[model samples]
Target: MPIPIELSLHRHSRVLEIAYEDGTRFKLPCEYLRVYSPSADVQGHSPDERVLQVGKEQVGIDKIEPIGHYAVCLHFDDEHNTGIYSWEYLYRLGNEYEARWNAYLDELKQAGHVRKTLDA
Candidate 1:
């Protein structure tokens, strides 16, 4: 698995910048991370039990806690601090960002929820 060489949080822009040793970099929005959190509260035990997170367009990370040599725990400003994001998972998230993001948008649209525009 590729390991992250750097992780930078851009609080003002609500983005987490991750650079991997394989020369791949991803600028993940906080909202995306929050909604796609790997926590049980979000992912659930089964695929059908997963929860769809809403109203997280402006969610920001309050803190990032490293978990040994394998993962990091994100503490969201919304008080969500359960997900243990492993290096592999983070890499996957980056790699599949476009498809995943579009899927999320589609799901929201199907649920009849309109996403609010974030204030710049």
Candidate 2:
């Protein structure tokens, strides 16, 4: 599995920058990470039970706790700190960001939740 060489959180931008040993990097929005958390609280035990996170567009990371050599636990400012994001999962999230994000938007639309656009 590809491992991250560095992780940087930009609070002002609400983005997490991940640099992998494979020379690939991903700038993941805090909202995106929060919504797609790997914890059972977010992902659930089964695919059909997955929870759809909304109104997290302004969420930011408060802390990142390392879990040995395998993963890190993210503490979101919204008090979500259950997800243990492994290196492999993080890499996949980065690689599949476009598709996943679009899917999330579609889900929100289907649920009649309109996402508020943040000012740049």
Candidate 3:
């Protein structure tokens, strides 16, 4: 697993920066993190049962807590705090960001949902 050496959340930019031991860094947008949350609400119990999240274009993290040297729990402003993102999962998310984000957009379109930014 590519463990993170540094983690920084930029509230103003609504991005989370994670630097790994291998010198790789990822700047993940809050909306992407929220929609792709590892929580059961999003991932479900199985691949076939995964839910398509929508209307989280402006979602942001309110807080973050490190979990026992393995993962981090993200507290979103929308009150989502169940997901515990492991270093491996986070690494995958970052590395496959473009494809995953595109897939999400396609899913939204197919579901006839429109992306909207929440008002500050």
**Tens digits of lDDT, candidate 1, 8-111:** 99999999999999899999999999999999999999999899998899899999999999999999999999999999999999999999999999999999
| Candidate 3 lDDT, 46-116, residue by residue in tens | 99989998778777899999999999999999999999999999999999999999999999999999877
Model 2: CA > 4 A from native: none
Candidate 1 deviant stretches above 4 angstroms: none
Once fitted onto the true fold, the runs of candidate 3 whose alpha carbons sit more than 4 angstroms away are 117-120
Q: Estimate each model's TM-score.
A: 0.98, 0.98, 0.94
> Could you give the candidate ranking by lDDT, starting with the highest?
2, 1, 3
lDDT of each: 0.95, 0.96, 0.93
Q: Which window of ten consecutive residues has the lowest lDDT sum in model 1?
A: 111-120
TM-score of 1: 0.98
lDDT of model 2, residue 20: 92
The per-prediction tally of clashing pairs is 0, 0, 0
Q: In model 2, which range of ten residues has the least summed lDDT?
A: 111-120
The count of residue-pair clashes in candidate 3 stands at: 0
